[model samples]
Structure formats: structure tokens, C-alpha cells
Target: MRNLEFKEKMHEYSIWRANLVQAIEMYQQWLTRYGMDDAHRTNTLLNILSSLKNDRITLAFVAEFSRGKTELINAMFFAESGVRLLPSSPGRTTMSPTEIFYDAEGGSYIRLLNIESRLEDMSLAEFKNIPERWTQLELNCDSPTQMQNAFKELIATKKVDRELADRLGLWNEREAATQGVMNPDTVEIPCWRHALISFPHPLLKEGLSIIDTPGLNALGTEPELTLNMLPSAQAIIFLLAADTGVTKSDLEIWMNHINRARSAKKQGLAVVMNKIDAMWDDLGGSNDYDRSIKSQIKASATILKIDEESIFPVSAKQALLAKIKSDKELLAKSRISALENYLSNDILRDKRNIMASIVMRDIGSLINESVNTANTALSHASEQLEEFRKVDFHNQDMTGKLMAETRDRQSLYMANVENFQSSRRVFIVQAKMLINSLAEERINEVIYAAKHDISKSLTTIGMKQNIRKLFDDLRDLLQDSVDITNETRRLVKAIHKKFKDEYGFKEIEPILFDIKKYQLELEEVFEEGEAFRTSAKVTMTEQGIVVDKLYSTLVAKAKVILGRAHDDAISWSNGALSPLARQIKDHKKQIEGRLQMLRKINESKGTVAENIAHLEAELVPLKRQREELAIMIKSMQLEGQLAESS
Candidate 1:
């Protein structure tokens, strides 16, 4: 017996199947005069039909440089050296965006994007030699051992020679020139700057894709990371070194890139107060110090307008090293335990909520549609079979005539049937694979790259100087905005007081109204200024990533293909297939017309599925951020109460 859920699902599927049948009939009539091959045309129709599937949720990590982003990734994903994605040093390991996903049969695959390759069937080591393009390739494997070997091979193949690195902007050419290196030979290496790895992980398999973006400045500089990737994220984890607290860059990031784009109803942001081990000695297990730290956290949250609970103070470096050495004792340490608990509980909870919402709304409908379309095609095939069997081919003495008619009818009917089955299989497989791939890719490309690059950029620029400059700029802006607000308030007050005195009015109603208006205007100006600051920061990040052109191009291509496929399917089914049968030929045209109407319905279903998938992916990060903000808001209220009590 079918369960209630299954029955309901089947009902929904039936509706879609009926709609699909009508579309097929219409497309056949439209294409009858064209004499196109039934097999090829039906294949095209199936591809269009498959678009009515749902997408999955993908989680990504984004933050500023050198805040232990990569260390956190290692702690979370690559505890074993053999499982690591990229070589983490004090400088950049990834210069481009990469994605990783899982393959069918529960194995892992690595897919590197934007790499130029000349050789077919290249090994992992050979990936390094490819030029950079927007193309991608896939590799298959499983287990930590396999992953480790693949990583090693990739690194070996793609290792940037010091001389080549300098020329390609990975290393400082000016510094090399100063060292008396003249006329060094340049190698023609592939422009492939990013690596993508796909792995089978429990969380990822469950429809979560984690993306780790580059450092703060890097994120800010990369427009694609923000406009294309970050906005699409379900949850964003912003990491700040605990010792530094929320630095100017962190503040800038929040105000500019994160805060505005976030949905308050959805948990969208979490601040990871990392490198807490550095503060361990200073804390000294003192209640006073703990209280002080908590107080400071609250104060910071209040100023930043963030939730305190979302601020997780952790030592990513210690956690990663502990995991790497497989030291159980170290892993059990309070700091490590705290971080782990938070991730498993608070983070996971938000992820679950987002997933549930998506499943109920988007994925559920898509699954139903896919099943229905398959059933509809099956029904049509059954009808065609019945018709073929009833035909009196035996009475026709001419074997050639009988054979030709049978072949033509069988070819057309079988083609549509085969195409439908193939499409259903491919859609289901690709959907699952895309989800798994995104998680592994993010860990390798964003997290690892940020870890190395942060340190390198800091060292190159002189950390103290750069930090000071960032702080000075932030402080000046904050002070200026505050000063302007205060001045405006004072001016409004003075005008009200003067007007009341001159008019000899005790109520001063008109003056009060004017003052209120001026205050509102002032508030608007302040809001605009805040928005401007955020936009400036986001713009910088966009410049760094160079994703604007890429995103636009991809989106455009997807739209065009999807549209053309849908239109072609409807035309072929309605115009080509309805004019053959003697008794039903006129009725066939009517059936063909029904197929056109069915096309519109199926197209709407496809659009709905796409929309739902996009929303589901977005909800995960948004919910997490919202939860973090809620915690900070509660902390701020508590602090206010304490200050009042005192």
C-alpha cells in the first residue's frame, strides 16, 4: 500500500504526465512537414523536459584574509593529511574559483574549472599545464588515500615555478627584478588558476555545499565572489582573529557587503572570533577575565548591531593542528570542544531548517513533475503499441510497403519513449552530483586559498601598517557620520526653539513638526551614507574576483538553451506527428494543438523548479546569519539592562 505522502506525490506526478502527453502531440504536428529524424527530435524534447527538476542547497564560507579560514576548513574537513585538498602555506594556493562534487555510486570527483587542456585523458599531474579558460574537467576517486594521492598529483602538475609565478602575477616581479634576476625565460603554462574537488561527505550528500571564499580584501576585490557567489549562499561565516576582535576590515565587511544583503527573518550571518588560543594565557581561568571578555563581546555586538550568540570565539589553528596530529586529548580540550559543539548544534540546526523549507517547497514539486512526465510518456508509448498491434500488416501482400510503414511508426514511437527514460535518469543523477560537487569544490578553492593568501598579503604589505590604515579610515568615517547627525539634531532644535520664542506660542506645534521633518531628512542622509560605504567595499571585492562577466555569460547561456529547447519540443510534437493516421489525422492535428498547450504548462513547472532550488540554496545561509544576529541583539538588550541596574 502506498503511504499518504507517496499517494499525494503520485497524484501530483499524474497531473504533470498528462500535461507532457499533450505537449508531445503538439510538437509532433508542428514538425511533420520538416521531415526531421524522430530519434534526434525526441532527444531534444527530453532534454527540455528534464529542466523541470529541483536544485539543491550549497553552503559557502566567506571572510577577510589571514583570519584562519583555511585552518578552520582543515579542522572541519581535512583532519587527515591524506584528505587535504590544497597545500596550505602562509600564501595563496588558489588564484581562481574552484568547485568540487560527488559522482554516482558514492565516489568522489575533482573538477577544475577555467583551465585550457590540449591532451585528452590527462592525468591529475597534467592539470597544472593547462591554460586558463572558463572550462572544467572531472576526476573520480574515493577514500582519504585516493584523495591524498590526487591532491599530490595535482600539486606536482600545477606547481608554479618561481620564475613563472612572477610572470603570471602569482609572485612579485618587482621583488625578483631587484634581486638581479634579468631576462628569465618564461614557460607557456596553462592558465588554469583554480582547482575543484568533488567528494562524498555525509553533510554534502544530504544536500549541503560549502564554499570557502578568499580573505576579506580578496573577497572585497572580487565582485564575482560577492555579487554572484555570496548572495547565493545559504549561510555566511565571517571569521575574525579573537585577539584583534572586530577590526576595521571586519566592520567594513559587515557594513558594506553582508548586512544589507541579508534577510533579517533568515539567519544570515555568524562571526567566528578565531585565534582564541592566543588569548588563553591572558584569560588565566579567571572569572573576572571571563566576565570582562563577555562584556566586551556584548559591547562589540551592540556597536556592530550583530547578535552575540553568533560570535563564536575559537582557535581554528589549534583545532586544525590537533586534528592533523590525531591527538584525542587535544581534540577534547575545551576550546576545540566548544567550536565543534557550536558547529554541530547551532550551525546544523539552521542548515536543517533551510533544508526542510526547500524540500517541502521546491524539491518535492520537482520530483513529482519528473515522475509525472515519465508516466505520461509511458502511457503514450502504450497507446502507440496498441495501435501498431491492431494494424493489418499481414493482409498487405507487399512486404516492402508493410516493412516501411512499420519501421517509420516504430522509429517515431520508440524514439520518444527512449528519450524520456534517458532524460529522467540523467536529471536525477546530475542533480545529486551537482550538490556533492559544490561542497568539495568550495573547501579546496576558497578555504585553502584564503589561509595561505592572507598570511602572504599581510607579510607583503606589513600587517601593522595596513591594519592601522584600515582602522583610521573606519574611525574617521564613523566619527564623521556621528558628528553630522549631532550637528543636524542641534540645528533642528535651535530652529524649533527660536520659532517658538518669536511666535509666542506655548504649544509650538508647527515648530515641532518642522523639527521632526528635518530629523527625518537627516536620518535619510545618514542611511544613504551608510549604504555608500557598504557599496564601496563591495565594489572593491568585485574587482578582486573578476566574476561579473562570467556570471552574466553563464546566466545568459542557461536562459537561451532552456528557452530554445522548450520551444523546439513544442513545435516538433504538434506540427510533425498529427498528419499520418487516416481516421485520426484530422483528430491528430487537434491532439497536436493540445501538445502546444501542454508545453506552456510544462514550461511553467520548469520555471517553478528553478525558482525553488534557488530559494532553497539561499535560505541556508540566510537562516544561519539571522540566528547569529538574534543572539547579538539579545546580548545588547541584556547589557542595556545591566547598565541601567548599575
Candidate 2:
């Protein structure tokens, strides 16, 4: 229902983000209208707006087969469909990792990637961009039956010979036999490796993305699920069957992927004890399963090493039935509203804070820079107006005196300009060295070396050794980057101090490039890589599958992060000295303009009153700009505070 608590909260969050984006857009227009935008600053602002426009609160659903992950999704967000949205039937319903969200461009569609794509070295991320690679099926959103039938494709499977299954690393003899489903002739594997569904659901339309992942075998084989998608989610809901408590496979998924994906403090993690209705005692009182649910919650917390507060016990099937039949009593018994409240309040609030931090990181410095430049210009304008007002127009000697003062100021500024040019040459040399070290060519060389070594390795153990060596090389690259970054910071700092001390420039600190954040990111990547390297699934997988998984997950992911660091370095070097340099240039121009104005009056071609009026006209806009800039900054601050407290 539109009045559902989760739906209402999601709507509120979307409106809040939309309003913030409007404020940001207005600021961009204000900068352009005032002729204050530079190439670098404008590009940065555009990038920030792009991030905001595409922002979504993503929650990943992770579990072993039949933990009711897809069923919970159906109850929580798609209950309005009045039937099961995703095919969450008995055993391995969602065979592949499926992402459900609204795509503005594609509208409504079911895009499935063929499982054969896993045979390639490309990652799921790369495959997403190549639309032709996906089998696009029309999704009739207006017809729930049609949509439900189409979703059955998510659970579609094809039988392949055991040899083919082994090559694909989907035939786990031990795992299959343990489940008593061993077959020598044929093995069933998902028809698709990944599915991307762009549906026009209301909550999804409000920038809510849901990832429904498969069982432990899939989690182990598909590194991207653990290494990329799971971590990127703002919240990860791990499902466990309440009737079975926490099984060995459930605990395996917890320890290896879900536990490793999050922090020790367990932020953004919710363990859902689904199928609580199965534990309901018909012979007992209304609160029959209350004690049973609480007992299992404590047991799950202890086994998973998370707080009991993080575990939610709910009946997805009952919740869906309640909503469909408009039965409030059943819904309460389902306890689905509690989980809905958590998603609405807790998860959405946390997501807002994360988004706020990103906005602050990207645009905060640029805003400060704009404010500083405007203040300095306004101050200069006031000084010019004061000097003109003090002039005695009838005293012709006054014009020559003003001209002489302007010339002296110009001489001092030009002296510093000459010194800046000489030091700039040295700065450019050091900057090149810093950027070249982070160049694509250099990054590729390391990647190529690692892949080549892995390809050459004859045995699985040798391949594992090669992967370890690659991480060492990657870490070494990061360390070298850190050293160069520090070197550049010292060089830039000395140059900044030079201009301030020698030229009487106002105190302004250069925004130095930060490599520590990137280092920390790479360190986490290394930890995950090591975990993957040592995982039994990876080591025991076929060599080709191992290579494919490594390329798509560990190697491809790191390369992307490193690529970002390089782009940031380029942006930093270009804009590092811009604020100070612009000020120097502006100061020189102002002095020259004043001298020209005085010469006109001294030559009897212009009146002192006319020049003073011209400066007065300029001051009006400058004053208005200052007011607007202050308002914009205050609005962002208030919005960020509200995000935290709300």
C-alpha cells in the first residue's frame, strides 16, 4: 500500500535528496551567472550532481537456498503486486544473483546475462554496459501474473554434462552428495549468471535497489557478490530459516562472506530469522512462538557473533498473505511491520548520512574557495570606492597622485609574478613525476604481469602463490604512491608558504592530495583478496573458472580503485595552485584598471564622479553574491544536520 511505513519513509528520503540536489543545481547556476566558474570547478560540480542523481539506497539479501530471501523481498516491497513478485518457490528459486531496481532510461525490462559469459574474463560490471550481451525480456508491470511468469526465468536452469559442469566449477560432488542430489550424467546450473531487473515498483522508483543473491555455493564461486556487490550495499540482510535455526551452510555464509563484508562493530548488518510462522504452535497461546523466536535470535547472535538487536524474526509468507487479504491481525503475527520499521527508519537514516558525507567531501572545498574569492574581490572593490571618494575633483593634482599610487602597487605585484613563474617550473616537474607514477600504463603493467604469472602456473597451489605475489606487487605500488604523495605535499606546501611570505598574499592553505584514504581502501582489498585466495572453493575450482573469478572480482575491482586515485591526482595537480594564482592575477588586473581610470581623469577626458559611479555599480552585485553564497552554505549545513538527527 502507498501508506506503508517503509514506502512513506522511502518517499520522504527521496524528497530530501531531491531538495538537496535542487540546492546544488541552483548553486551551479549562480556561479555561472556571476561569471565565477572555472573549468575545473565546473567539472567537479557536475560530477557531484551526477552522483546525487544516480544515488540509491541499496540493500543486499544474502542467504543459502530456501532461506526465503526472495520471499521476504516479495513481502516487504512487492506485496502490492498481490501475488509473489519473484519466483521464491521451494529449492533454488533464484538461481542467479538478481538486482531489482528502477532504471530511468530502460523503464521496465528483465535483462539476464547468459551463464556462458562467465567463460569470459570480463566482470558482471563490464557486462552490464554491453547491452547486447544480455537477453532482454519485456516486463509487463501492469499485469502481476505476467510479471510473475517472467520472473520464473530467474530460476531457470539447464542440464549440462558433468564434464561441462566441472569446467564451469558448478559441479561440487561433495556439496551435492551432502544434499543427496548427486547425479553422474547431468548437473543443473543456472541458465544465467546474473540478472538485472528494471521494474517500475513504487519503492524502487524512490531510489531503492535490492540485490537478491543465491546460496553458499554461488557465493563462493561468484567473487563479485562478496568482493563488490555485498560491500557496496548500505545494508545486507542475511536470511536463516527459523525452523532450522543456523545450519552449517548458513554459518559458512556468515563467516566467509557476510561477516567479512562488514565491520566488527557490525554496522549495516541485519540477520533475518525468516519462516517464523513454521514454528508457530497452534495448541498454545497467542504468544506461542514468542519465546522460541527470542531463543533462536540469541543463538544466532552467539553463533554469528553479532548483537541480538541485529536479528529480526519474521514470516515473509504470512506477511505477503496478510497484505494481499487486508488482514491486519495476521500481519501483526507475521511481525513484518517491525522489519519494515527498521528498513524505514534505521537503514534509510544511515544511508542518508553516507550520502551527506560524499556531498561534503566533493563540494565542500569548492564552496569555500568560491566564498574566499568573492570576499577578496568585494574587499578590493570597497577599497577602490573609498580612494575615489576621498578625491578632490577640482584639484587636478589628485588624479596624478592616484595614478602614481596604482603604478607602485602594480610594480610590487609584478615582482611576485616573476618569482611565481620561476618556482612554477619546478612545481610542474615534480607534479609530472607524481602523476606518471599513477598512470594507466603503469597500473596495467602490474596487472599484466600478475595475470601472466597466473596463466603460466601449472598447478592450483602455484596459481595461489601467483595471486599472493600479485597482491604484494599491488601493495608495493600503493606504498610507492604514498611516498610520492608525501613528497608532492611538501613541495606544494613550500611553494604556498613562499607566495604568502614573499608577496604579502593572504594566508591560504593549499588542499593537498590525500593518499591515505586510497591506501586504506587498497588495504581492505588486500584482505579480501587474501580471503579469496585461501578459500576452499576458489582453490579447488577449475583453473579456468578460478582465473575468470579472479579477473572479474579481485583484479578488476582493485584496478578500478587505483584508476580513481589516478583521476583524483590529475584533478588535484591542475587545481592545486589555482586559488592563489587567480587571486594574484585578479589583484594585478584591478590595479591596472584603477590606473587607467585615473589617467582618463588626469587627461580631462573623464570625470572623477563617473569612475566612482562605475565602481559603485560593481559593488552592488558583489554584495548580493556574498549573501547568496552564505545562504547556500547554511542550507547544506542544515540539511546535513537533519540527515544525522532525523
Candidate 3:
């Protein structure tokens, strides 16, 4: 797996981020010197800087047990270890969700939260915030033996009392019977609820995080994984065995977690058909290996109802063995290179563009505001200075005329500022109302209610009808979001018209408000939801798998689907009004500039000239700063375009 492109892209983002921070810092200092410190604006800039500093691209691996998922990760990322770094034997090794990344500030350590912590009813995120709640083990990267020993903690299991197991929902008599662990007095569970491993891998050090999640049972119990981590991930790799194809349990995981949690727009989803080495080749040169792999890929794609191209046939074991032995021929046959190319070219490229869009949206707006403020202040100061120099003390009549005209002109300017103020207020109230209608809390409530209604409706009969109604309700909610976005766009156009035509406000552009893209995504999800319900009916007819299991899977999958919808809705609504928000801020700054002009005009006659001269002198540096910022923004955009093309 080559990460040359990924590394270069990240480096570019780092440079752009640093430059933006420098600009913001300089602007903040300039504001402080001018006695115009705005805490809200400073905090906003600081928050952006913080986000840039902590940005990470997450690649999440998910699958049913024994699909060689960890083997693939070790091959693609840990080839330098010269052996398998993660346990990937025949049975379940990763019993809980494990995250691997380099914690540059915290140094190397393995942090584990005890399984008993789950009983406390606190989330994994909350548990993480309190370091005292975790067990931390320092890691030594210099010693391979120590690193291997430390990693064994990921596989550690403990015997739990039957009563505790039952309370923790780990003991299901019927499921245990199916697994052939019948009539157990005690159950074995992972000692840790989750694991965080920090090491000095090249990718990890470069802000790449990998999440290794266990099978269905583990995911079914972790609400934080389903609700937070998975959805926030940039990409999700669903691993399946090529020999067995998509089993009932694999379908459960896919429907319940992988497909439902991934964003529809980003669509950062891939299927790795692992264990391709198991497909036997015919002795008579019939090309059976390729044909068998192709057949399995087609079957799995149809079963999952996803694009055929997204399914990759790979031999994880062969890939790892080939890498360790430095066998180039075997490595080529492993097909891991194709998957790596997909990640570097598709996933990382998309991430770069997304990061660029955000940087342009926030940092670009900031720089633009600084330029507008500086220009307004500079222009006012220059005009006042020129007028002051024109004042003739030798001629009292000329001075009187000049003073009267300046007062009249100031009155007109003040009236324009007042109108701008009132319009800005109107715009703010309208924007707030529009934004609140699509609030995250409100959308989450709608999703939860739909999930609740659908889950309650999933019985043996009339299940289809109830599920359809639930989808209809969701469709209506999505339409409501669309309506809100459209209304906001309309109101923004009105505001722009009033400011540009009535008040001569410069640089007014209509905000881009399009929830139609997100609406379509929701529509696609609705279709998928319908397919899920239909698939459940089909599963009910299949032997060995019970209807209750199908129903439970449907409920879990529906909840995740609804949750992703809420996330997209909130993101769309918030992003839709960002431009308008910037414009509103610009209007506020313009008003402040006018007020400053009025104050200067009302100052003592002697100091007004000095103040104007000082303000004029400040303009040269401010203009230079604005010019430099504009060049930096253009360069960043160009680099983003190049990265996208590459």
C-alpha cells in the first residue's frame, strides 16, 4: 500500500492550516491594538484553529469474526513489523472495538476501559474524558516483544458470573446453544469494553486513525460505537469471507451498522471479499480462480443491494505472508494493491476536497471580513483627513460651509448605517428562525420517534404497512427541511436586494441554499429502508434464522439509518446559512466603522487631524496583509484542485 499521495495531501493541508492560523493571529493582534477586541470573533477563530490542529482521517474496519479483517490491516499498515501485528487466528481475537492511532502529545500508551464500566451507564466518550476511569499501560516501541505482549490485551477474556453476564446481555440461552456453548454456568467476555492503542506507525503519526470493530454481538451492545464513532468515520470497510459469501449474520451487521451508519453523500463504503485464497483453481487451466472470485463478488453485491464495483476480492493471508517473505509475485496475486489504490485515490482524495471546502468556507470568510473592515476604516479615515486639510482657518465663512456640509453628509451616512442595522437585525431573526427549524435536537427527535414507531410495528403481520408509514413520516420530515432551506434562500435574496439596491451595500452575493442534494440522499435511504424490510421478510422464510432475530436486526438498522439522516440534515442546514452569516457579520462591522467615523467627527478639532493621520498610516500595512491573505487563499484553492485531479 503506497501512501505517497495521501502523505502529500496531508502535508498541503497542514501548510494551509498553519498559514490560516498565522493570518488569524495577526488579525486578532491588530484588533487588540485598535481597542476592538471581540471575544466572540476571537473564540470563533480559535475554535477553527483547534479543529484544524486535531483533524484526523478515520478508516474503520468492520466485519463478522474470522474474515481476515485484522490480517488485511496488518498487511496494509504494519508490513514493517515483519510479522502479523494484530491477532488474526481462526477464532474471534478482537472481541471489542479497538482504535489505533499515534497520540503525539500523550506519548505511546494502551488505554483500556474495563468491561464493568459498562454497568455504570456512562458512554465510552464520557469515560474517556475522565482518564481515571481507564487502565493505562505504557508501550515501548523499541522492543518488538513488548509490543506484541501489549497487543495481547486486545484478546484477553474473563469469566463472568451468569447473573452478571445476564445483566450485561451477554448470555442468551438460545444463541449460546446455537454456538454449541450449551448450559454454561458462566460466560466469558472481553475484560475491556474498548481499547485505544497508540503506536509510532507512519500512518498513525500522520493523523490517520484505524478502528477495528468486532462482530455483530459486540456492536449490538455498544451504543456509542453505533451512534457516534461509526457515523463520524470518514470511511467504513466491511469485510466478508469469499468462500462463505454473505451469511445471515453478515447481513445483520451490514444492515444494522455498516450501511446505515455511513453518509449517503460521502458514501465512504467499501466491501473487502477476503479469504480469496480459499477459492480453488482448476488444474486444467479453466481460470476457475478468477471465475469463482467474480461469482462471489456478484452474489455478495446482489445480496447487499450495492454497486458491484465497491466489492473487492482480496486474499489477506496471502498478502501478509507475501509481504513478510518479500515475495513480489505472491504479493501481486493477493490483490491488496487494488484496495490500497482505492483508498489512496478515492477515499483520501474525497477527504482532501472536503477539508478544502471547509477551509475556504471559514478561513476565506474571515479574511474577506478583515479586508472589508480595513477598507471601510481606511476609506473613512482618508476622506476625513482630506476634509480636515481642506479646512481654512484664515477664512471663517469657508470653514462654516465645510462644517455644515460635513454634518449633512454624516447625517446621511448615519441614516444608511441605521438602515443597515435594522436590516441586519431582520436578517438575523429570519436566519435564526430558519436555522432553528432544522436544529439537531429537533431532527433527532423526529428520527427517534420514527424509529420507535417502526420498531413497535415490526410484528409478524402488517409489518410492511407500518414500516412504509414510518418511511413516509421520514420523507415528510425531509421535505420540511427542504422547505426551510428554500425559505431561507428566499429571505436571503430579499435581504440582499434591500441592502444592495436600497442601501448600496457592496459585495452582496446570494447564499447557496440547496438541501435538494440531501433530500435525494434521504430518498435513497428511504428506498434502502424499504429494501431492508423486504429483506427481513425474505430472511424470515430462510431456515435456521428466526423471525425475532430478523426483527431485532431491522430495529437496530432502522435506528442507525434514521440517525445518519439526522446528521446529514443538521450538517446541511448549518452549512447552508454560513455565507449569509458571514454577510451579516460584515454588515455589523460596517455599522461599527460608521459609528467610529461619527465618534471621530465629534472629537476635538485638534486631535481629529492627528487621529485621521494615524488611521491613514495603518492602512498601508492592513492592505498588505489583505493582499497576502488573498494570495494564500488562491494558492490553497489551486492546490486543492490539483490534489483532486491527482
The candidate that wins on TM-score is 2
Going through the candidates in order, what is the number of backbone clashes in each?
79, 0, 0
- Candidate 2 clash total? 0
Clashing residue pairs in candidate 3 are: none
lDDT of candidate 2?
0.84
lDDT of 1 by residue, 428-465 (tens): 34333323322334323432343234334434234223
RMSD of each: 23.8, 2.9, 6.9
Candidate 1 Cα misplacement greater than 4 A, ranges: 1-55, 80-86, 91-94, 105-109, 114-193, 260-266, 282-296, 321-329, 332-646
Worst 10 residues of 1 by lDDT: 505-514
TM for every model, in the order presented, reads: 0.42, 0.94, 0.72
Candidate 3, residues 168-274: lDDT per residue as tens digits? 65666778878888777889988888999998777787678999998887887674576567878989999999999999999999887776687454378889999
Q: Is candidate 1 or candidate 2 better by TM-score?
A: 2
- Write candidate 2's Cα lDDT for 413-485 as tens digits: 9888888887778878888888888888988999898888998899888999999999999898888888889
lDDT of each: 0.44, 0.84, 0.69
Best by lDDT: 2
Off by more than 4 A, model 3: 1-37, 263-266, 280-286, 373-403, 416-503, 507-623, 638-646
